[model samples]
Structure formats: structure tokens, C-alpha cells
Target: MNHELSLDLVQSSVLAGVLLILGEFARRRVGFLQRFSIPGPVIGGFLFALLLLVLRQADVATVEFDTTLQEPAMIAFFTTVGLTGSLSLVRKGGRLLIVYLLACWTLAVVQNLVGIGLAEVLGVNPLLGIMAGAVSLEGGHGAAAAFGPTAEAMGAEGATAVAVASATFGLVAGSVLGGPLAGWLMKRGKVRVPTLVTASTGSTTTVVDQGSDTGSDSGSDTGRGPETENAEESGSAGYRKLLSTGVLVGVIMVLGTLLGTWFSDTTGFVLPGYVGAMVVAVVFRNLNDRFGWVRLDSGTVDLISGLTLGFFLTMAMMSLKIWELYALALPLVVILAVQVLVLVVFVAFVVFRLLGGNYDAATMAAGMMGHGLGGTPNAMANMDAFNSRFGVRSERAFLVVPLAGAVLIDLVGLPWIVWCMNWVG
Candidate 1:
């Protein structure tokens, strides 16, 4: 008999940390992985998951993890994403964000249509097709899991299994595809990020080269190192900022809960749990930006957001149950192959053109592919990786991609899935 080892919440969190550390080491040494900018957590998480699968398969050991931290981590990470959106950034990226969001909704509609239409052609039940479509693909495991019971209730046998398997394929495929897609688009189009050029005619130009990771130079980098140093020296002030910002984030999350609950309860329009918190954070950020009510540093907020995102993804990926994917793999491959072809064409012809045929657009296209195929974390990893290697930080892509993929698409996508179910039923 195989030994069964079940970890509690604390142990699971620690394991996730270990996986991230190991993943980082692998990413540093792996040539192809480094060239593409694959995130450390993804590398580590997948490796750990595969290890679990292997152990279980061999009947040497079976491990169970308490995944209680996963959802809260996701919610917290997304809330930080909302914090990234100041009113100024919004004003600059508003049109692009809106357009990208609309494109996602359209894509969701198309995904369902393709899945359902092809399922009919193949003589599979259309209800089963819906599970394979946006539910599993664009929505990932969470959405698939959410819709699974409903589909089963509607008479689709083994709906949950099908959804989980399809989503697993999508997660891996999306991760592999995103970095390559963006790289290809940028290379083929000969797109390059615009470099800042100043006409230095006897004018003192202070050049501080901040590394590629943080995008543009901050105030400290612009010959203001003294001010930055002074700020750093003020230990009390730094502590106050940290405490205040932490408290504010907590307050915003609480407010978001109340607002999200009210929005869902009062109106029939249900939203994902994190959306409300994120929207509230956005409001707070914009308010702070405009009125200077509280000094919220963009750099600080970004640091916190990055931390949350890393931990969230680490915990989430470490809990992957891979063995369950094998049984439903065959049918999904054909269905998903068709889905991928559509994504390629759609991204090349439609998404690229409409968003703009520039480097930022290419990065955004890659991000869209990530979220469209996998989920939000995949999208972020793709964009982050592309940006890390190439220094193409499209603020518009960062703001729009997560909100659309994580929250906005779900609004219409879920309804559309159910409608397809009702139509077929």
C-alpha cells in the first residue's frame, strides 16, 4: 500500500516557497527558459507537480495538500493589480484597456462558438463542448470547477473530470506558448521599444541606468540619489509608510468585500470575488493620486504587488493534480488544437491590428494568448518574462490584461456558457 502524506496549510505554504526557490535556480541555469523569460514559480511549480504525479503513479507515496491559502492569495494578488492603476495611468491607457477588454469578450464568444460547433460536427454532446470552450480554456481550472456541477446537473456525465483535464492542458500550453508568441511577433514585425533621446547641446544630462526589470527610471535615478538616500535613512518615516499602506490595503479589501457583495446581491450581475476589492483599490489609488489624500508610492505599491503575485502563483501551482488529466486528454487535444489555431490567427490578424501594430501591441498579444489559453497568472508571467528580456513594459497591457482576463471576461463568459447550455438542452 502507498503511504499517504497530507500536509496542513503551513506546510503547504512552506513547500510552495521551497518550489519557488528551486525553480529560480533552474531558471537561472536553463538556457531556453532564460532566453524566453519563463517565471521561476511556474518552472518550480510544474516540476513539483510532475514529481507528485510520478510518485503517485509509482505507488510509492501519495500526498495531499491543504489549498486554503490559494484563493485568498489570488484575491490578494489581484487586489494589488488594482493598486497599480492610478488615474493618470488609466487616462493614458483607457482607450487601449477598453478595446482590449471588448476584444476578450468577443474572443470568449468565439471560443464557445467554435467549441460547440466543432463538438456538433464531431458528434459529441454540445454541453460537453461548452466545458471545453471558454470554461476550461480561457477561464482555467477555477471557472471549469465552478461550471462543472452545473453541466453535470444538466446531464453531462463526468463534466468535472473533462473540465479539469482540459484546463490542465491549457495551463501548460499557455505557459509554453506565450513567451514564444510575443518573441515571434516582435521579431517578425521588426518592432523595437523606443529609446529616449535628448538633444544634449552643452546641457548637463544625468544618465542613471536602471536595469531592465523596473522599466523606466524613478525620481531617485534622475540625479536625485541624495534625496532617495535621505528617504531611506528616515527609518521612522519608512515604517510609517509601510504600516499606513498595509492598513490602507486591508481597508480597501474590506470595503471591496462589502461593495462586491452588495453589487452581486442587489443586482443579478455576479462578479468574481476579487473584482470588488480591485475596483475599490483603484478608486482609492485614483483618489490619492488626484487629491494627495495619502502618499501612496507607485514604486512601493508595485513592490508589494509583485510579492503578492509571486507567493500567490507559487502556492497555486504547487497544488496541481496532474494524474487526473490523463483520461480526458485524447478528445481535448483535438478540440484544443482547433482552439489554438483560432487563437493564433485571431491574435495575428485581429488583436495585433486593433490594439496597434507596435512592440507594446505584440507584448499585449502575447499576454492575451496567455490568459486566453491559460489564465491570469499565465498572462502576467508572459508579459513579465517578455518585458524582462526585451524591456518592453506596456503599462496598458499590465492594467488591461489582468482585469479583463481575471474579472471582466468572467462577467460575460459565464452567462454565455450557460446560454449555450440552455440552447443545447
Candidate 2:
């Protein structure tokens, strides 16, 4: 007998929350997963997905989810990312950002080339390779979905399944790869971690410090205490600023949607809506930074973003169509294996060398592995894992990698990936 259960949007969200709780518990209990820096959602969501597969195979039950909240969760998560795009933070990374962006663009090109080449070797469509490459790997699931329609329209069978599967593979691979690779680089290079090493430079000030810079009327002056600003911003004034920032974020999202639609309609080249939101968000953040416009609190922004990202990942993992992976599974596995080899070589040699070939470079290597392999969070998890043991100051890496992944990749890299997709299709 087969049972079918359909859940409403709220119920599905509640189920997602349950999955996240279970995921967190698993992270705490599973030593191997903990040691390797496996994200809680990845474990829990994948497990659930596997269970779904087993049930389907057994003819036990079919579960249907109203995933209405997933897209909004995605948008909200990215919006929080956008809030962090202060020009000041961008300025902090300076040339490092420029080089990393170039490296990422180069990586995109190489991924496409490698993917397309593998398709040829396997006697498949080049478009399949492109979808599996930057479109899925670097672009993650969002880009995969965006590009999937076009691929299907162009006669690529099971395009969506391949893209999603590859991205899922990337998340796990990226997480596993980053920590160990960083550890090797640190051990081999004899890199110094700031936590372990003395602060030879004058101030031990951090982004959090600059973030609290609410009191200073001028950019040169330092920010006030976060607590002080928190206290002051709590009254009517704070509430007002909070509302204003939220409104602005909403407006940015709407505008981004419009812009992306316009571009896709007019240019015949497509982009994600979040790209527009982030671009506008960065502009707003910088303007607010300079003009004291409605007192943006970094802590608040982080809180909103963190919650959204957590939910977004949970939904993303839970919704994986793991059963669809059987088509071209052998070839897809080979393609992914080659992509890993390429990523390892690039991170081990190219990334480490370009960023100064020092301790900072090593830390950034770990961080880049996070975003490079999956997304920004994996990069943080990788950096966090490496930092926990080695005691390195990865502040710059934390700032730079996320910025590049969230903003630059969409702006600079997406176009190239789309052009390739269109060309191949």
C-alpha cells in the first residue's frame, strides 16, 4: 500500500525547522562529521532526503511539500549578505579583492572548459558540461535553476536533475576539502595565525569595531561601542532606522527582480534577481555609512541574515531530488571528480600563491575553499575549522570571500556563465 501526505506551507516550514533541530543534534553527536566541519543542515537534510528515497523505493509513502517559503528564504538570506557590502569593507580588502575576483572569473572559465571537455570525452552535449560547471558549481542551485529552463528549452534532457545533483555534490566536497587542504597548507607552509602570533601591527581592531562606528560623525573617527549604540538605537529612533533599513531591503529586492527581468527580456542574457538587490544594497550601505542615514546597526543586519541563511539552507537541502541522480550518474561522477582535481590544484597552488604566499594567504585559501567549493557558509566553516586548531587571524579572509561569492560572482561571473550556456545551447 502507498500513502500520500501533502503538507501546507506552514506545516512544511515547521517540518524544516524540525529538520534543522535534528541536524544540530546530529552535528553535536557525530564526531566524524564534527571533525570535518560538515554543516548541520547538509547532514540532516541529506539524511531526510535519503530516507525519502528509501521510502519511495519501498513504495511506503510519497510526501509532497508546499515549498512556497523557500524562494523568499533565499531572497532574505541574500539580502542580509548584501547588507554587509559596505564600501568600507570593500576598501579594507583592497587589491586582495581584485585578485580574488580575477581568480574566481578565471575559475569559472576553467570549470566551463573542463566540464565541456569532459562532455566531449564522454560523448555528451557541451551544454551539459556548462550546466555542471560554473552554472551549478560556482553559481550553486540558484543559478542552476535559473539556467535550467534554457537548457531544457534547448533540448538538454534532465538538466535540472544534473545541475542540482552536481551542486549537492559540490557542497559536501567543498566542506570536506577546505579544512584538510588548509590544514596541509598551514603545516607545510609554517603559516602564522594572528591568534597565535603577536599583533605586530598597531591596533587589534576588527570589523566588529568598525561596525560599531555609529557614534563617529566622520569616517576617519572610530565607531562607538556596540552596546552604547544598541542602547541609543533601542528607542524610537532605533526602531525607525530598523524599519527604514528593512523597507530599503524590500525595495532593493523588488528592484532587483524588475532589473533582472528587464535584462533577461532585453539582453537575451539572464541573471539572478538577488544580483540587483545586492548591487542596490551595496550602494545604500555605502551611502548610509557616509551620511549617517538612519543608523544601520551591523549586529541587527547579521542577525536577520544569519536566521534567513539557516532557513534557506535547510529548505534547499530538504528539497533535493536525490532519486533523479541516476541518469548519467557514472559520467556525472567522473565530471565531478575532475572538477575536484582542478579545484584542489587551483587552491593548493594558484590561490595560496596569489594572495601573498603568507599565513594570511593560507587562511584565505581555506576560506576561499568554502565559497569556491559550495557557498560562503562553507568557506566560514572551513576557516573556522582551520582557525580552531591553528589559531590564525582569518578576519580578512572572512570578509573577502563572502563578498566575492555574494556580490562579485553574480555581477562578473554570472554573465560569462550565461553567455557560455547560451552559446552552448
Candidate 3:
């Protein structure tokens, strides 16, 4: 075989390409996967992993870890995630955001502690357990790659291998545990779904129609109302203003990061560049809302989030080493089982109660399942499932869960993982 077209390289690349295409198709076409819940990227990644594993076991394909490709892809994904800190959404989320952050932080602490304890009992270095548990499982692949190297340098022999195993198990366990918890909660709580008509009726009645009398006076005026005309104009103008504000916000975030870095150096207090940018964005968003500087742009926020996650997932999936996972199977399974149990109990009792317990126990359960296990995508999937059968008030769940998963948990988890490493190592 020619060097460039060697069987191993060509086969691996082709397999990855095929999986990506098929994953996208499955995401669009498969209703059950989308609705009842499983992250599309994870589903795709796992299937690819399985295929590679089969090939390797059969002696048909070989994979060599290229540290070069792994690090850059992982870093790029993390940087993109950093860039997605939308000021407007952070402002809008408000106290709920704070709550979500706290929850994430708390969960990270619990997860790491559990891992360390388990590691001690199992007789491996607790650092190995921590890396394989929360850092990989909750934080996903990028984190696994980040800390896996550190773990190896510190003498955990199979750090990356353990991290991958933990992450794969986390993805699976998170998906499985979230839905059933949601279902059980809904059944137990007997929460009734609120009607959209009923919720809107009260708000709608408060707006007095000045054209009500005019409609009665002439049939010609019956087809349209002043309120409707004003609404259409306002909606268009609001959207335009939101777009303008979003662009300005992005610019401000960049500038703020530069300023923050300067201040950090002079004042001896340094913030992570991305964290500084997020804080600035949050301030800008709140200022815009408070003084009416700009209307919030929902579309732009959605677009940024979607693009960031897509690229991140793509990079993450490509870097996975399915072959490395075969070495650490026993401990990975134990860690995953414990983590799942913790998530199920915590979400069912604690998260649901904290979120005001008004939602169908099922929907809340699904949200917890997603956030606690897999992250926001998993939670969204669970909510989609509940929405299909129970109706879609799950929006509240969606809003809160992602807020917790993306920003809050990461900020909190990094420190906890570091602490665990210190204590255990």
C-alpha cells in the first residue's frame, strides 16, 4: 500500500467521514432518538467507536494515537465554547442562572469526592479515579483529553485510556438515567400540564383594544385593528434592533477581554480570559435590558450556540480513541454506576424541589437527567421526550439545564478536579 493511502489511515479517515454524514442524517430523520433522548453526536461517536473496536479486534485496522491532532482539536473546541458566552442570555437568566451555577458547582464537588473515595477503596491512586470519573464523565471528551495528559504525567499510567472509558460510560449512563427519573417524578407528583390558552388569556385580556368600538361601527374596519398594525411594526423593529445590539455586544466582549488582561497584570488579580469576556457580556446584556439600549436578539444567540456546539462535537468525536478504552473497563464501570445513582437521587429529590416543584415530575426529572449525566444536550433530549408525550412547558427546564451545564459546571469543576488531584496524588 502507498504511504498516504495506507490501509489504516484511509480506512480510519473514511470511517470518520461516513459516521459524521450518517450522524447528521440520523439526527434529522430519527424521531425516536431526537424525542425520547440521546445526544446525536454521542450516538454517532459511540457507533464509530464500536466499529473501530471491531476492526481492531478482527485485525483488519490499526490506530496509532497522534498527540498532535488530539491537542489542537481539543483546544479549538474549548476555545469555541468560551466564545459562546452570550451577554443577553446571561442577563435574561438572572437569579435562575445563579442557582444553576451553584447546582453545577455542588454537583462537581460531590462527583469528585465520590470518585476519590471510590479510588481509595479500589486501591488505585485517587487521582486516577478522579480523572476517570467526574473530569471525564461530567466534563466530556475535551476535558478528558485536557486532564488525561496531566494525569499521565503525574504517574497515572493509563490516564487518557481511563478518561475515555469514563467519558464513554458517562455518556451512556447519563442518557439512560435521565429519562426514567423524569418519568417516575411526573407519575409521583401528578403534576398537571398548564394550558397555553389559559396562560395567555389573562395576559391578552389586559390589553384594551381601542378599535373595538370602530369594528362595530363599520364592516370595513372589521378586518384589521390598530393593535395588530402596531404589533407587526414593533416586532420588525425589535428584531432589527436586537441584531444591531448583538453585534455590538460581541465587539464589546473582545475589547473587555483586552482591558481585563491589562488590569489583571497591573493589579495582580488575573481572571481567565474567557471568564472575563463572559462577565463583560453579562454586564452589557443587563445594561441593555435595564436602560433599553437594545432589544434582546434570540436568533443570534441561538445561532452562535448551535454553531459552537456543532464544531465542538465534531472536533471531540474525531479525537476519541476507542482502542485505548479496552484497558480500563472494570474501574470505569464501577465509577459510572455510582455516578448514575448519585445523579438520579439528587435530581429526583433535590433539583426538582429546588426548581419549585411545579413542573411535571417527569420533565424536571428529564432536565436533571440531561444536566447531571450528559450535559445540556442530554437534558434537551430528555425534555424533548417529555414534551412529546406530556406537552412542552419543558422550556423552563431547557433554559435552566443548559445554563447549568455549559458555563456554571465548567467554572466550578476545574477547581474541584485540581483539588482532588492534589489530595489524592
| Per-candidate local distance difference test | 0.74, 0.74, 0.62
Residue pairs clashing, model 2: 193-392, 213-223, 370-379
**Candidates 2 and 3: which is better by TM-score?**
2
| Model 1 stretches astray by more than 4 angstroms | 86-90, 94-105, 112-236, 259-270, 287-291, 352-425
For residues 23-109, what per-residue lDDT tens digits would candidate 1 score against the true structure?
789989998666444567767876777788888889989888886876565566556667765546434547887778788888889
Tens digits of per-residue lDDT for model 2 on 1-425?
Answer: 78998989998899888898898899889887765455676667768878888888899988898878776666665666666766565566699887887788788889998999999899877888887898788877556654554576778776766776777678778888887887788778776655455656566755556543464554234566556667876776757766776676677788767876888799876555665566567667678789976667777677667666567667666766767667678889899899989989998899898898777778778777766757666777777777777655577777778777766666556667767776776
Q: Count the backbone clashes (under 3 Å) in each candidate.
A: 0, 3, 4
Clashing residue pairs, backbone N/CA/C < 3 A, model 1: none
Q: 1 or 3, which is superior by lDDT?
A: 1
Q: Give candidate 3's error at residue 384 in angstroms.
A: 2.8
Please give the distance, in angstroms, between residue 318's alpha carbon in candidate 2 and its true position after superposition. Answer: 2.4
Better of 2 and 3 by lDDT: 2
Per-candidate TM equals 0.66, 0.75, 0.66
TM-score of 1: 0.66
Name the weakest run of 10 consecutive residues (lDDT summed) in model 3. 1-10
